[model samples]
Target chain A: MSTLNEVLTKNLHGLYYGNRILLPFKADILKAVIEKSIITDFSDFSEQAEYEIKDNRTEIYFYEYADLSEFITTYETIKLIVVEEGRDIFDIKNHIKLILHLNDGHEIKIEEAGENFLFIE
Target chain B: MRKILPVVLLAFLLFGMTNQVNASDFVNPAALSAEIVNSDAEHSLPPVFMVIPFVTLLLLIAVMPLFAHHFWEKHYPKFSIALGTITVLYYLLVMNDTHSLLHTLAEYLSFIALLASLFVASGGILIKVDKKATPMLNVIFLLFGAVIANIIGTTGASMLLIRPFIKINQDRIKPYHIIFFIFLISNIGGALTPIGDPPLFLGFLRGVDFFWVFEHVWYMWLPTIIVVAAVFYFIDSRNNDGQEKSKEYTGQIEFKGYKNVVYLLIILISVFIDPNVISWVPNLYPLPFGIREIIMFSVVYLSYKTADKEILSSNEFDFEPIKEVAYLFIGIFATMIPALQLIAYEANLLGDKLNPGIFYWATGLLSGFLDNAPTYLNFLSAAMGKYGWDVNNAVDVHNFEIEHAVYLQAISVAAVFFGAMTYIGNGPNFMVKSISERAGIKMPSFFAYLIKYSIPILIPIFILVWLAFYYGRV
Candidate 1:
C-alpha cells in the first residue's frame, strides 16, 4: 500500500477549504477505493443520494467539489456495505459533528446547529 | 474644514508653479483646445520639475507607513488627492496637455473599476478550509493561489483566499507565510494573464494581445514559481516541529456565496468587451471610459448591495482595502504622466545604448519601489519610444510588440515579479499586509520585508530568470 504522504505528494489533488482537506481521487485510486470498499455510505438514501466515508468521528462529505462521473456511480455500489454495517453517521456526543486539532495549539469544533453548521475555532 | 484649507493652498502653490494662464481663456475654449489637443501641434516636453509630485508621493508611500503609521492611516486619502491635484493643475495650466491627462484619466478609471468590482465581488464569496497546517499542504495552497491569481487577479485571489489561509495556519502561523503569500499570490502569480495584474491590464488596454504575455512569460514564470515555492517549502519544513498529536480528519471543505462566482465570471468576460476587441461593442469616445468600465462599476454596486451578510461578516469584508488602493492609485496615475514622458524621451535618445538587459533591471528595480503598474507603463513607453513608436497609438503599440517582443517580455515579467519586493510595489501587497495584520499576524515592516525576505529570497530567483530568459538578447 502506498503511504498517505506518497498519494498526497503524487496522484491525489487536494484543495483545502472549510474544516476538511478535499481529496479528489482519480482513476486507479478511485477504482481501488471502490474495489477495496474503503468508503461505505451510512445513510438510507442508498442509491440516489451523495456518498460519504466514515472514519471515527470524522465524516468526509461528498456533496461538494468532486465532479468525476465515477464518483457518482461508485455511490450505488458502496451503499449496500454501509447498510450491512448498520453504522450511524451521527454518533458523536453533544451534537459535535467534528473536532480538528491545529499545530498552533488551537482547536476547531464543528457542531450541527439546526440547518446550519457552526464552526467554533 | 481644516483639511480643505491645505488642499486649497496646495492648489494655489501648484498654480504658482505654472506660468500664467488667464481666467479669460475659458471664454474661447476652442482656441486653447485647438492649440493643445491638435495632433499636429509640436509641444514642448514636460519640465523635469513636473516629476517631483510623483517622486514625492512614492517616497511618502514607502516612508510614512513605517514612520508615521497613525497619521498616514488618518490622512492618506487627503495626501493622495492633494498630490494628484498638483499634477492635474500643472498639466492643465502649465503644459496645456489635455490629451495626455484625459488618456490617463481613462486608464485610471478602468484600473480602479476593475479592482473595485473584483474586490466587492470576491468579498461576498468565502472559502472555509478545515485542514492541518503541513508544509506540503501549505505549498499546495500557495501553488493553487498562484494559479487562481491569473483568473481573478492578484487582488481578487488574495482577498478570497488569505482569510482561509490564515485560519488554516492559525496555530503555526508565522510572518513568513504571509510574506510568501504576498510574493507568490499577490505579485508573481499574476504575470501570466492580463487579468492577473494591473500592469498587464494597462498593457492590454494599450493594445498588447491578451494571450501575448502568457505565451512569452509562462516559461520564465513557471521556473520562478518553482524556485520560490521550493524555497518556501524548505523554510516551512524546518519550522515544523512534527510534535502535534494526530487527530481524525474528515477532509471537509465548505464554500459559500455562489452568486459571487457568477459575478466573477461576468467581470472576466467583461474584460474582453472593449470596442477595440469586438466591433459591435459601442465606443464611448471623448469620454474617459467605455462600456467595459461601466459594466465593472455596475457590478461593484450590485455585488456589494446583494451580498450575503453572513458571508461578508465571516470574511471580515470591508471597503477600507479597496478605498486605500483607489485613493493611492489615482495619485499615482495622474502624477506619472510627466515621468513617463521624460523617461520615454530619454529612452528614445539613448535607444541604441539601452538593451533588453538594461530595460529589465531598470524596470525591475524601480518596480520594487514605485507602484509597478505605472512603472510598467513608464518602461513600456520608453521601450516603444526606443523604436520611435507611441504607446498610446494602438497600431504603434501592436507594431512595437511584433518588432520588440523581448523588451515587452522583460518589462512585463519584471514589473509583475519585482512587485513582490515591497509593500508598495503592487496594490494587493498592502491589502494582504493590512488583512494579515488585522488577523493578528505581525507582518514585517517595509524595510524588514525588503531586507529579510524579498532581497534574500526573490532577488536570486529574479537573477536566475534574467540569466535564463533576458541575457544578451538585444
Candidate 2:
C-alpha cells in the first residue's frame, strides 16, 4: 500500500462532506467522552446540540455538537432506539444524540438553547 | 442603556443614507466628471478623491478588528453601509451615470449571490475528520483543497475544508498549517479557471474563453502546489511532538444533507445563462447579470427548503458571515470604482511601457490590499488601454485576450494568487480566520502574517512563475 492516508483521502473526498472529516470510529470513545469529560456548559440551535466539556483531570477542552433531532426525541421511541441502536447514538458519527441518564438519576445531557432558536456561535 | 447609542446612530445613518441615494446626489457633475472613463456611451471616470473612502474603509476592516475589537464587531455593518453610501451618492450625483451604477449593482448582486449560496450549501454539509493531525495527513488535505478549489470556487472550497482541516489538526495546529492552507487553497488553487476565483469569473464575463486559464496557467499551478506542500511538510514534520495521537474516529463516517449538492450544481449552471438586456435603462454592460442573480438566489432557497434543518444544525451553519460579506463588499465594490478609473487613466499614461511583468506585480500587489475582483478589472482594463482596446466593450476585451495573451495571463495569475498575501485580499480568508478562531485557533494578525509566513513562502513561488512565464513575453 502506498499509504492508508492516501487511500483514505481519495475515497473519503467523494462523500458528502468530501473533506475526509467523515471519520469512522469505534463504539467506545463516546462512552469515554461522556464519563471522563466534565461538561462545563451546553447549548444548541433549534434541534441542534452543543456541549462545552473538559477532560476531568487534565482540564483539556473538547466540544460535541450535532443537530441529531431528526433521529431522536421523547416521542415514546427513545427506549426503542436505545435497545436497537444501543449507545451508537452517542458514537463519534457526524452527529451524536443529546444525553443519557443512569438508574441513579445522575445525568449527562446537552441543553438546547440560543438566538431565535437558530444559528451557531 | 448600553445598546442605545449604536441603535440610535444606526437609525440616523440609515435614514440619512436612504434620503440621498440617487446616482448624482452628492458630487458636482460639472466638476468631477472631467476625466470620466467611458463605461458606456457617455460615462466618465470617478473622481480621484473617492480612493480615500475605499482605502480607509478597507484598512479599517483589517485594523479595527485588532485594536477596537468589540466596538468594531458591533458597529461594522453600520460602518460598511456608511462607507458604501458615500460611493452611491457620489456615483449618482457627481458622475450622473445611473446606467453604469445599475450595471455594477447587478453584477455585484450576482457575485454576492454565488458566494452566499456556496457558503450556505457547503456549510450545510459537515465533514468530520477522524484522522490524526499528522504532517502527512495535513498535506493530503491541502492537496485535495488545491484541486477542488478550482471546481467549487475558493470561498466554497474554503468553507467546506477549513473546519475539517482545523478539527483533524486541532491538537498539533501551529501557525503554519492554517497559513499554508490560505496560501495554497484559498488563493493559488483558484489560478486555473474562472470557476475557481471571482476575478477570473469577471474575466469570463468580459469574454475570455473558459478554458483559457487551464491551457495557459496549469503549468504554473502544478509546481507551485507541490513546492508549497513540501514546505508545509517540512515545517509540520519538525514540530511533531513525537506522540502518536493518530487514532480513527470511533464510528463509520456518516453524512446528512447530500442533496444540497444539487442546489450547488444549479448555482453553477446559472452562470452560463445570458441575462436579458434592460434596454430602457440604457447604456448597459454586456453580461445579463440579473438573470444569474435570480437563479442563484432561487437555488439558495430550494436548498434551504429541501434540506432537513438537522443538516444545517449538525453543520452549525449560520447566515451572519454572508450578511457581513454583503455589507462590506458593497463598500468595497462601490468605493473602488474611482480608484480603478484612476488606475486605468495612469495605465493609459504609461503608453507602451505596460509590460507583462509590470501587469503581474501591479495587479498582484493591489490584490493583497483591495479585494481582487476589481483589482483584476483595473489592470486588465489598463492593459487593454495600452493595446488601444476599448475598456467598456466586451468584444474589445476579448480581442485584448487574443492580441496580448501573455499580459492577460499575468493579470489573471496576479489577481487570483496573491490574494493569499493579506486577510482582506480574498473574501474567504477572513471568513476562514473567523471560523478557525471560533474553533479555538489563534491565527496570526494582518501585518504579522505577511511579515512571517505569506511573504516568505509565496513571493518565491511567484518569482518562479514570473521567470518562467512572463519575463520576456511582454
Candidate 3:
C-alpha cells in the first residue's frame, strides 16, 4: 500500500525537474530576438552605449535597410554606419557600410577598398 | 478487599501520570543519532527524475528563441522565477536540508563572479587592430587571439578581440569567418591554462595544479592550433577570390579606456590568488570568498563612472546579453544539480573502472549543450571518484594527477575545446555572436552553426584528438 508521503515526494521531485529545465529560458526569450532595427528602442537607453573594449570605441550610424522577410509596411532600406572613433562619429565617410546579404541577404558593405570606397553601382 | 482494590487503582493511575510527566525529559541517544543520519541522507541523491527544471530551462533557451520568440521574451523571466522557486522549494521541503542547495548557490556565486566580472570588465575594452583583410593577416589575427586567449581567459580574449576582427573583415566576411573565429578564439585558444576556460578554473579549484594544463596539454595544444589555423588559412585564401587587403586604415592606431587593463588584471589576480591577500593580522588562513570580486566589481563601476561618455557611446555597450546569461544560467546551475549527481552516481555504479577517451568525449558532448562549467565538474568528479582521489590529501592528489595525467588531460581538453560545438557551449559563444550580430554580422542560428561549421570542421578535429591521444589509452 502506497502512503500519501510517497505520492507527495514524487510530485515534489517532478516540480524540481520541471523548473530546472524551464526557468532559465523563460526569463530571457523576448530580449534575445534581433529585430530589423535594434536601434529603435535602445536608441536612447544609455549615453554612448558602445561597450569600450580597448583604446577605441565602436560607433554605429543607422543608414538604410530592407527586411523582405518582414512585412513591406515596415520594410525600409535601413542602413547603419559605424565609425570606429573620434567626435566625428556621425560622419559617414565616402564609404557606406553596405549590407548586401550580410544579414543573410539583409545588412555593411563596401566593394573594393580605397578607390571604390564609394559605391559606384 | 474491594475497598482496597479501588484505592489501589487510584494510586496506579496517579503513578502513571507522574511517569508520563518525566518521560518528556527522556531521549534515546541512539534514536536521536539515527534521526540525524536520516536528515543528512535526505539531501543525498535527489530523485534522478528531478531534472525537469534544468532540462526544461535549457530546452526553452535552445528551441523557444527560434519559434516562439514573443512568448519567450515576454514570459521567460516569470517562468524562470517560477521554476527556480519550485526547485528551491523542493530542496527545502522534500529534501529536508538546505546544505546542498546552499552549496549549489555558492558555486553560482563564483560562477557568476567569473562570468559577470568578465562581462563588465571586458565590455570596457574596445580593441582596434588595423590589419588589411588578407587571408594571412586574418590567420595571424586568429593566431594572436589563440595565444592571448590563454593569457586573458577566453571570455576576456573574445571580448577584447571580436570587434577588431569584425571591423577588419567588415567587407569580406563569409559565414565561415565568424564560424572559424568561434572555433579558434572562443574554444581552442582556451586550452592551455586554468585562466583560459571555466572548466579548467573549476579543475584548478579541485587542486589540479594551475600549471598542470600547460604541462600536459601543450602537445595537444600546439598541433590543434596548427591544424585549425592552417585550415582557416586555406579556407580564407580560397574564399578571398583575389580580393586585396585594405591599406587606407593606415592611421596610427589609438586606444581608449586603457586603464581598464588594471581592472582586468585585478579581476584575474583575484581568481588566481587566495582571499588571505586581504588579511589584516597576516594570519595564514584563506577567507572563504576573496576581495577579488569586491575589487573587480568596484573597478567595473569606476571605469563606467569615470570614462569619457564618448567612449561608451562609441562602443554601443548593452546589458541584454549579460542579463540573458545571468537569468538563464541560474536556471542552468540550479536544475543541473541532479544531472551532475546522476553522472557521479553512474560513475560510482561502474565500480571504479575509468577511461580517458570516453571521459573526454562524454564531457565534450555534454558541454556542447549544457553550460560547460558544471559539466566539467561532473566528469571530473566521475574521474576523481573512480580513482578515489581524496581532496584533503595533497600527496594523494599529486600522485593521482601524475599517474592519471592522460585521463585528466582528456577531461580538461574535451571540456575546453568542444565548447565551440554550439552557441550555448561556452560563456563567450552567444555573447560573441550577439555582439557580432549587433555590429552588423548575422551569425547563423544554433543548429545552422552546428550543421555548417561545428559538425563539419570541429567534429572531425575532435575525433582526430580522440584517435591520437585517447584511443587505446582509455
Candidate 4:
C-alpha cells in the first residue's frame, strides 16, 4: 500500500495522469511491470517520450520512448515491487531498480546508478 | 393573409383575458394598498437594463452581416479588416466597463476556445466521412448532441456539436433543415437533466440535486423526445426527398486525426467537474485551483496540441462565429443582471399563491423569448421561497406529502422544454441559423422560421405532450 506521494517523491522523472504514473524503464520491462499491476491494456509504444519527475528539493525532466499508459501503470507497479522486495522503498534509486522486473517475473532487482545494466543486456 | 388573421385573433384574446383577470384580482383594499406600495417601491428604483440585451443582441446579429458587407465593400476591402474593426469596437465600447472585465474575458475566452475546438474536431470528422454516409451521420451527430447536452449542458453541447452539424450539412442545398436542428438538438433535447439546459444548470447551483430532475423525466422526457423526433423525421424526410443524387466526393472515408476524440472526451468529462458538481464529490480534498477550472485549461491545451491543421484549414475555421457570439452575449449577460433581479423580486411577490401549472407555462413561454437559464432560475427561486424547497429541505419535503414538489418539477420541465420554441430562446439556436445560412441554405426570416417551421411542427407535439403527461397529474 505505497502512497502516491511517497512513490512520486522517489521517482523524480516519472509521468502521471490523475493518480497514475509512468515509469522510466525499457519497453519490455515496462510492459512486464504493467501486466503484473493490471492497471492498463498495454499497447504500442511511443517513439518519443517525456518523463515528469517531482521531489522535495528539485524536479527534473527526461525524454525516452515508451507506451504512455503502460509506463504510468509500470511506475505504480514499481512502487509495489520495491515494498515487496523488502527494500527501503523510500530511496528513489531503489524505486527505479524495482521497476526492472526480470523474467520469472514475480521477482525484481535494483540496478545501481552508474552501473552498466544496459550493456549487460 | 390566412396566417396573419389567426395571430391577430390570438393576440387580442390573450390581452382581453389578461385585462379581465387584473381587474377582478384587486378586491381587498388592504391587500391592494400593500401591492401598490410594493409596486411603487419597485418602480422607484433606478430602472435596470433587462430587455435591452435580448433586444439589442437580436438587432445587432440581424444587422451585423449587412454592416460587415457594407463596411467591407465601401472602406475596408478585406473581410478581416471589417471583422477586426467590429471586434475592437465591440470589446472597447459595448462590452467595456459594464460587467466585470475579468469575468467577461474568462467567459469570452472559454466560449471562443470551445467553439474553435468543435469546429476543428468536426472538420476532421467531415474530411474523413464519405459523402454517402452524411445523411445518416447528420442524424447521428444531432442525437449525439442531444445526449451530450444532457451531460455537459446546452451551451457546452451546442458549442461542441454545432460545428459538426454545420459541416455535415455544408454541402446541402436546403438550410432551413438545420434551423430545425438547432431547435431540437441544441435546445429542446437538453430538458432531461439539470446539466442539460442553462436554467436547469442554474437550478442545480442554487440547491437542486443533480439527480432530482430525473423525477420529471416521466412527464417531460417522453413528450419532448417524441415531438423532437417527429419534427426531425419530418424535416429530414423533406430534405432527403428534394436532394439530387450527386457524386460529391468519391474518396474513401479517411479519418486522419482520430486521436482528437480523446480531447473531446476530456472536455465532456470536464462538465462533471464544474464547480457545482466538484463540491459534491465526497471525501475529495480541496485542490489549489477549482477542479473544473484546472480541467478547462488542460483540455484547451490538449485540443490545441492535438488538432489537425489541415482539417482546420479546410473548414476555414474563422473567428467570426466566436466573435459574434461573444459580442451578442456580452450585451445579453450584462443587461440580464437587472432583468434577473427584477424577475427574482416578482417571483417572491407571487409566493405560494402561484400554481405550478401557471409556473410551468409562464416560465416556458418567457424562456422561449428570453434567455431560458435566467428565466428558469427566476421561477425556481420563486418556487423555492413558496415551497421551502432549497437544498437543505430537498429531503425534508418528502414528509409533507403535498404536491408542492410536483409543481416545482413542472417549472423545471417547462423552462427546459419550451426554451426551444423560438430562435433566440437559446444561445446556439441563432448561431446554428447563421452557420446554416453561411453554408448556403436560404434560412427563413425570424418570424417566418417560427411560423413555418417551429410552430406548426413543435407546438402540436408540445400540446400532445402536455395533454398526455403533464395535464391531469398536477
Candidate 5:
C-alpha cells in the first residue's frame, strides 16, 4: 500500500493530467504546490498511486490520516459522472462520492453538495 | 474613459455646425420631381400581386416564431426559401425580369460575405474585463461599443463584447442591460457608417459613398448614444445594491486571439476594394461578385482555420448563427425584389407628396416590424424612384445622395435606429437576445420588449432625434 502523501501525489497527477475536470480553487493550490516543489517526487507521482475508473464514475481510493494539516495540500477531486466533462459544477449530479478509507478502519464519503463538497464520516 | 467624453462632445458640436456639401447645387427640386414622374412611365412595373410572396415571407417571419415556434424553428429555412422561390419564379416566368433577380443576387452575396467574415473573425477574439461593474463603467462600455460598431460591424462587436459584458455584470445583470446593449451596440451604434449595419452596407453596394453616412449621421448618433447611455446610467445606479461583497476584482482587461485583429483590418480594407469606388479594381461583371466579395469570403475561411482553438472554445464559436443569417437572407434578398419594384413605382407616382418626414415614420415603423435590411432597401428604392432614378444604376444612386440628402438621411437613420425597437428588426438583436437568454437572463418577450422597454425607452429617443434632425424638413 502506498503512503498517504504518495497516494495524494498520484491523485493530483491523475487529476491534473488524466482528467479534464479540476476544481478552480484546488487547481490554483495544485499549481502552486507543483511549481514550488513543496511535494517531493511529484514528477514521478504517476508511477506509484493509481486511480480507478469504474462504471460511469472515477474512483480515487485514499486512506485518511489523523492530522488535517497532512491533507492540506491534497486536492479535492470532484468527478462529474452523469454530466459531460468540462461542464460547470452546478450542472453536475449529486452522486459524486469520494471514499476515504480511515486509519481506524472506518470509511468516510465526500459528496458534492450544491456549489460545495460535503464530507460525511 | 471620463476624459474621452468631453473630446467626443466637442467633436460632436463641431460636426453639427459644419455645413454639408451638396453636390447638386444647380439642380432644381421641383423640376427634378416633375421630371422623375414623367420618366417612370417608360418601364413597365411588376404586377402588385407579385408582391404577395415578399409580404407572406415577412409575415411568417414575424408571427411563426411567436405562434408556431416549434414549427417555425424546425422548418424556417424551407418556408423562407419556398416564399422566395415563388417571387423569383413570378419574376422569371411572368415579368421576365432577369436583371432584377441577378442584381439582388449580387447584393445578397455581398451582404452575406461581409457578415460571415466579420462573424468568423470576431468570434476568434475573446475580451475579458475583470473589474467591478459600475454604472459609469457600463455606460462607457456601451459608448465604446457604439464607436466600434462602425469598425467591426454591429454583429461583430456584439459577438465580441456581449459575453464579457454579461460576465462583468453577472451579479447585477438585468434584462434592461441587454436591451440597452441591443439598442446601442446592435442597432443605433451602426448608423454612422455603411460598414456598421447591413442596410447601410446595402446602400454602399448600390453606390452610396463610404464616408457619406459618417459625414451626415455622426452628429445625430452622438447625442442619441449619450442620451440612451445616460438613461442606462440612471437605471443602473438605482439598481446597484445587490452585488456580491466577497468577490475581488483585479481590474485588468485581457484580450485573447489578438492575431484576428489583422484579419479584421483585412475585412475593413476589403470594404473599399469595389470597382465603383476604386477605378483600378476589377468589376467582374455578370458574375454578381467582385474582388471585394472574394477577399471577404476568403477571410471567413482563413480566419476560422487559423484561429486559436482555445479562444474559439472560450467564445463557444460555431457556424450556426451565420448559417441561419445566410439561409434567411437569401430568401429575404430574393423576395424583396418585387416589393421594391412596386414600392419604387408608387413612390415615383406620389413624387413631392412623400417628404422626408413620411419616409422617416414609414421606414422606421416597418423596420421595427419587418427585417430592417429589406425595409431599408424598400424605402431607399422608393426614395430613388421619387427622384426619377433607378436603384440598379450606380450613378443615379450616387446623385440621389447629393440631391435628396434629407430623404436618404431620414430613411438611413430610421432604418438603423428603429431596428433597436424590436428583436426581429435587425439580425444582431435576436442573436443578442438568444445569447443573453443562454446566459440566464430572462429577456422581455416581443410584446413585452415593445411595451415595457423599447416603446418607453427607445421611442422617446427616436422622437427626439426626429424633432432635432428630421422634423418638418422636406
Candidate 6:
C-alpha cells in the first residue's frame, strides 16, 4: 500500500511512462540515442539537467507487469518497468502499464486519469 | 500627407515659373534672365512624367476593393495603401502639366505592375509546385534569379522572381536565411552585365559597349559568384541543421496543369526583347499596331487560364503583396525623380576632383541607402564629365590616369556591392525578408539587420572584392 511518491523517494528514482520520456538528464542524450547509439560522458548535462529540458514534457510509454519478480532484482532498484500484451513494448495498440519498484520491494503503478499520474494499484 | 506636401509645393513653383516666362527671353537679355529663372523653376519641379501617374495609380490601387482583403490587412495593408494613395496624389495635383512626370510615372508603373503580375502568377506557381521539391525548387529559383539578373536586369529579375521566393518560403516555422541569399545572389550576382542592372543598362545606352562588361568579367564575375556561393552554403547549412525532418503529408500535391511554365518563359523572353520593342523592330514586323501588346496580354491571359485552380485555391492567391509593392514603389520612384535629377544635373558642380576610389565609396554608401541604379547613373555621368569629352572624337580622359572604361567598371561594381547593404537598397531584399517573416523567421530590424548580419558577413566579402577586383591586377 506504499504510495508512488513514497516509493520514488525511498528508491531515489522516479518512473516516467508515456510515448517518449523527456529525460531530465540532457537533450544530447536523446540526440545521441537517435543519431549515434553510444551515449558516453554526460558532463554537458547541467546541474539542473538543462540539455534534456524541452518546452513541453517528453512522452514515454506506460506499462504494467503481472509478475513483478520477473522485472525486479536484488541489487537493482527498478526505476521503471513497462508491460504490454500481444504487441511489441513500443507498440501503441497495447495498453501500457508502468511500475516503479524500490530496493525495499515497495511498488507503485503509474496510471492515466486526465493526465499521467503515479498511484498505488 | 506630410511627405506629399513638399512635392506639391515644388510642382506649383515649377508651374508658375513656366507660365510667367516670356518667349522672347532668348533674344533680350532681361527676358533671357527671366527664361533662365523659369528653366530653373522647371528643373526644380519633380519629373512629372515619373511622378503623376505613379501617384494616381497608387491612389486607385489603395482604394480598390481587391486590395482590402485579409492578406494585405495582415501584413502592411494600411501603410502600403496609404503610401500608394499619397504617391498618386502627389504626382497628379502638385506637378506642373508640362513635365513628363505622368509619362515617366506610367513607364515605371508599367514596370512595377508587370512585376506585380509576375509576383502573383509565380506565387501561384509555387503553391502548385510539389511540396517535397520545395527546397530544390527554392535553390532553382535562386539560381534562376541570379542568371536572369545578367539577362533582364536585377530589378526585372527581382520583380519576376520575388513572388516565387515569397511563396516557396511561405510555410510558417521555417528559417529566413533565404532573404540574405536573395540580396547576395539575385541583387548583386548580376554585376557583370549592363543588362543585369538598370545603372549598367543606362551605361550601355550612354555609349558604353554592350560587351564592355565582359572585359572586366575576371574581376567582377569571380568575386560575385564566390561571395554568393559562400553565403548560400553558410545559410543552407544553418537551415538544414535547425530543421527537423517532417514526414507528414496529406498526399494532395499534384501538378494540376503545367502549361503555365511556358507563360513564365515568355515573360522571361520579354525582358530580352523589351529593349527591341522600344527600338521599334517589333513594331515594323507588319503585324497589327498593338500586336506586341496583344501578344503580351494574351500570354498573361493564357497563363491565368491554365494555372491549376485548385492550387491557387489552396494558396488563396490575393493581390495584397503586389498592391503593397505597387504603393511603396510609387512613392520611391516619384520622390526619387527630384533627387536623381539634382544628382544628374549638379554632379559636375560638385567637382570631378573625386577619384575612382572616392566615387566608389560615395556611390556605394548612397546606393546602400538609396536605390543603386540611379546612384550608379549619377556617378557614371559625373565620371564622364570629369574625364572630359573629345567633342569631336567622343572619348576623352581629362586629368585622370586610369582608362574611362576602368572607372565605369569600378562604379558598376560599387553599385552592385553596396546595394546589398540594406533591406530597401534593392527590390527583392525587402520581398525576401517579408516572405521569410511570413514564414516565421524573426528577421532583424533595419539597423539591427546591418549590425548583426551585413557588417559581420558582407564586410569580408567587400574586402575580398576590393583586393581581387578594384585594387587587384586587371
Cα DockQ of the candidate 6 complex = 0.01
- What local lDDT does model 2 show for residue B409? 89
Per-residue C-alpha lDDT of model 3 across residues B1-474, encoded as one tens digit per residue = 442242223222212222222221111100111122223334477786788887787777767767875567546665555555556667666765454444455455456666666766666666665556788888888988988999888888887777767767766776678778888888889999988997787666556787999999989988898888888888888875325533476634456667777777877887754422223422221211234445555766776665555445345555556656656666665666566666656655662666887888888998887767767766665676567765333465567679888877988899888899988788788778766665556567677888988898888988999999999885
Which regions in candidate 3 have their CA more than 4 angstroms from the true location?
A1-121, B1-42, B241-247, B275-289
Question: What DockQ, between 0 and 1, does each candidate earn?
Answer: 0.01, 0.04, 0.03, 0.01, 0.03, 0.01
Predict model 3's lDDT versus the native.
Answer: 0.59
- In order of lDDT, best first, we have 1, 5, 2, 3, 4, 6
Worst 10 residues of 2 chain A by lDDT: A75-84
The weakest ten consecutive residues by lDDT in model 5 chain B span B25-34
User: How many steric overlaps does candidate 6 have?
Assistant: 30
- Best-performing candidate as measured by lDDT: 1
lDDT of 4 by residue, B1-474 (tens): 442242223222212222212322222110111122233343332245434544555554445444553342122212222332333234334433212222222333334344444443443332334455244556666676777778756655665555445544543535555665676677877877865775665555445666777765645675567557656665666565324546465645444456666666666565455433454633212111234445555665566456676544333333344444444454454334344555656777876667666777778777777667656656765666575654223343332213456766767777777767776677677666654443334456666767787788767876776666557563
Q: What TM-score between 0 and 1 does chain B of candidate 5 receive?
A: 0.83
lDDT of 5 by residue, B238-292 (tens): 9864354567779899888888989998998988786555678765643556787
What is candidate 4's fraction of native contacts?
Answer: 0.00
Which docking category, incorrect, acceptable, medium or high, applies to candidate 6?
incorrect
Candidate 5, lDDT over the whole model: 0.65
lDDT preference between candidates 4 and 6, better one = 4
State which candidate, 2 or 6, has the greater DockQ: 2
Q: B43, model 6: CA deviation in Å?
A: 2.5
lDDT of each: 0.67, 0.62, 0.59, 0.48, 0.65, 0.47
TM-score of each: 0.71, 0.72, 0.72, 0.57, 0.70, 0.56
How does model 1 score by TM-score? Answer: 0.71
A1-121: candidate 5 lDDT, tens digit per residue: 3322333445422222221222211111111111001111213253212234343334332212233223322222222222223434463232232322112212222232221111111
Cα-based RMSD of candidate 1: 16.0
